[model samples]
Target: MRHVSGLLVLAATPIGDPRDAAPRLSEELARADVVAAEDTRRLRRLCTDLGVEPSGQIVSYHEHNEAAKTPELVARIAAGDRVVLVTDAGMPSVSDPGYRLVTACIDADLDLTCVPGPSAVLMALAVSGLPVDRFCFEGFPPRKAGERARTFAALATEPRTMVFFEAPHRIAETLTAMAEAFGPERRGAVCRELTKTYEEVKRGGLATLATWAADGVRGEITVVVAGAEPVVADLDTAVAQVLERVAGGERLKDASAAVAQASGLSRKVLYDAAVAARAT
Candidate 1:
């Protein structure tokens, strides 16, 4: 029997500027057997901007209907359709629709690929002036005030840069919550309208950013916050804590390593001190 070819293509759309759309995106959009879009209207506008008309069936695949539509799309792909998936902006499945379809395709053992393009998270982090060596993309903070506060507080000790998306209207309240939870002096950057004509990146302490957004900013917002500084631990204190844990049945080496990690001290120093104390 001749093998039938099938594939699922996830194409990333430009976040703000149409010019950032990838050339491969236009090619796939034009040649695919099925174009599943988060918003068919937005896809049409994008096609107009790219100057490429999709020569395939365009179907609506969004949050509201994805659960029901995924099976149909999977069946079509299983039968040799080249289905291209595109969200309203940025890559699909990154705080966007298409995750279900992708998982569905995986379960069916179908081939899949992606058309790379612009990402608001990367763009924001790059311009945020924070330490980008290590970072975390925290989609969107909780909307409710209490939940939001609790969430930020839990991440207060995070030692890697953090990135988040926020609605323009809620930016002020969100920033204020961040200020209270992560400390007003904690530095952060508010990137608005990235890659667009009115692009702006405001870098400063979290409190300052909160005050700036209090005046009511507009457009897409991406915030990047610097990581918490490592806690400086005293050698005597860390050794005592390790010894206490060891007294509670943990191995001396294991206790020392755990205490060193929590206190940001040297594991070797902690272990040696604990051993010395035990010997004495």
Candidate 2:
């Protein structure tokens, strides 16, 4: 590959097992003028395992500091520096700190490249046993109860398989909420500690998974939900759900809004569907 001048290299580190680290990653780490890592300590350990020491400056770049560090990283790259960005594991900026920096580089008109390696997203999606042809990653959901419910509700009718990252403590609650919003029988998978020694993947209906998670779980968790099955025009069902929400004290417009948002159908579409259902 031609050497990319002034490129922001987004390198992927091994999610686990140092041996999984790619040869190109080590080479880039050694050759780059600046290395922006999500966790500098982890990067140092990875370097030790790879038997390659970074000769250039290594700077901390993570969620808390990404906004502050983006411009500095962009400036270096624009100056024709080869800047490598890495996260604690997997690809940087995928639910990591690299997005801001990558966006900054693009906005600054700097070249960008990648040394792709392990990705939990693809790994889980591949093993998920769900349709992988089309999918979306909805990182972590809101931590608060109401917001999380609303978020999941918004995706209740999403037709594309959905992937999510959830902390161990909240996985059960998230699964429960997902079951309630997407339906208990919706097929899904919960992958924990992927690519690690104790890696485990539990696949089943949302309700079953929620039950298993109720006792508590641990390690990094990635949830893959099968997309919603296409629903035929059932004006009766639509009207019933709408009336139910409204009966629960939601205003007509608010209920319609919730249904529209969740189903990815326009409010006007659902409103018309609801009206037709009530007439029938």
Candidate 3:
């Protein structure tokens, strides 16, 4: 039971090639009552590229001011305004702004919809050559070395293929850390400048990708890592893996949980068995 006077539209912009901009995006841009753009300058450029001029008022809406601006946008939606949200590239809210605004709209019981278009996550996964049937998008890994390593460690045994967005400058270090946590030979793909003229997809083991990226990668980066191979479900084997991780400085509880998740074993059982193994 919701009363909606207006519609909040989340529109997807082209990530690289301008031609990828959907026809409906042009219509949305032209007909919207208010256009919330992550970068107004970029929005203007996009309008020029699409050969369409936005008839609506344009306002800057990005991470820095999304919290303060979300309420206003929601109010506009409640007033029956057709508000369109667009980021610099791809769909908004994936790794960009618009999440706050979306939630605000929902809270206000305003209508919401999206003009589905290009997505870097889906694009990267599709071209990654890794199994995309079951995959998870991890967004951007932490920027700090220690934090990044710990993050990757938690997902070390993740069975679903993982996708991550990373800056060009940190791609080498991130891949190196992934190798350390996920193993040197684990397969992965580095997608760079996707859909652009310099688009490149490098598929190789984590160690190889790390080394290749050390030469310095340039452009937006999307990393797709193969999931961990399934481990034997034997309680003893699972416990041994848990103990091994604990010996390597991981907390016993974390190790137990990680192994249990990756191996389809009971966390309580793994923890108990590992404790008993240690006592002996």
Residue 278 alpha-carbon offset, candidate 2, angstroms: 16
* Tens digits of per-residue lDDT for model 1, 1-280: 4325989999999998999999999999999999999999999999999999999999999999999999999998999999999999999999999899899888888989999999999999998889999999899999999999999998998999999999999999999999999999999999999999999999999999999999999999899999999886999889899988988999988998889877889899889988898899
What are the C-alpha RMSDs, in order, of all predicted structures? 2.4, 5.0, 4.1
Q: TM-score of the candidate numbered 1? A: 0.91
Per-model TM against the reference: 0.91, 0.83, 0.87
| Poorly placed runs, candidate 1 (over 4 Å) | 1-4, 242-258
lDDT of 1 at 155: 91
Q: C-alpha displacement of 76 in model 3, angstroms?
A: 0.9
Residue 176, candidate 1: alpha-carbon lDDT = 96
Candidate 2 versus the native: TM-score? 0.83
Clashes of 2: 0
lDDT score at residue 41, model 2, on the 0-100 scale: 97
